[model samples]
Target: MTDYETIVYVERESVARLMVTALRAHGFSPREILDGGLPGIGTGLTGKGLAIAVPASEARDAQPLAEALLKDMVGK
Candidate 1:
């Protein structure tokens, strides 16, 4: 029942999990939301989309770290 600010949207579960791990590594707690890409409950059941959220106060610090981690993951 807590509110969270969306930090990133990822299509792959692996990436989302990795992001969460990386965020935690840097001392930020993150929450994942599986938002169905399609309409209705079916999307929630079978969607490949995901969202990573963190506390509003932590978002500013988390973003750059997350971006860096993702870049490292993607080899960019």
Candidate 2:
């Protein structure tokens, strides 16, 4: 099994997809995990969020670019 490192947590699917696209555009491979799938009938409802992760080795190389992308995204 391969271990993945969590990079960013996004509350909206659209934001998550945008982050993924940005990562890809910057030449970094990222993965998205949709948490809060149905389990105990509404138990995980509040946990519905998306997580973006990349390989541990690539994290350091991707951080600056991701940060810049996020800055542009959030208008910071």
Which candidate comes out best when scored by lDDT? 1
| Model 2 lowest lDDT segment of ten | 40-49
Q: How close is candidate 2 to the true structure, as a TM-score?
A: 0.66
lDDT of each: 0.72, 0.69
List runs of model 1 lying over 4 Å from the truth.
32-48
Q: Each candidate: how many clashes? A: 0, 0
TM-score list, all predictions = 0.69, 0.66
After superposition, which runs of candidate 2 have C-alpha atoms over 4 Å from their true positions?
A: 33-49
lDDT of 1 by residue, 1-76 (tens): 6667877656566777888988988899898544445553331343534667898889999888877876787665
Which lDDT tens digits does candidate 2 get at residues 1-76?
5566766555556667788888988888887545556554332245644557888888888777776776777665
Could you tell me the C-alpha RMSD of candidate 2 in Å? Answer: 4.6
| Cα misplacement distance, residue 4 of candidate 1 (Å) | 1.0
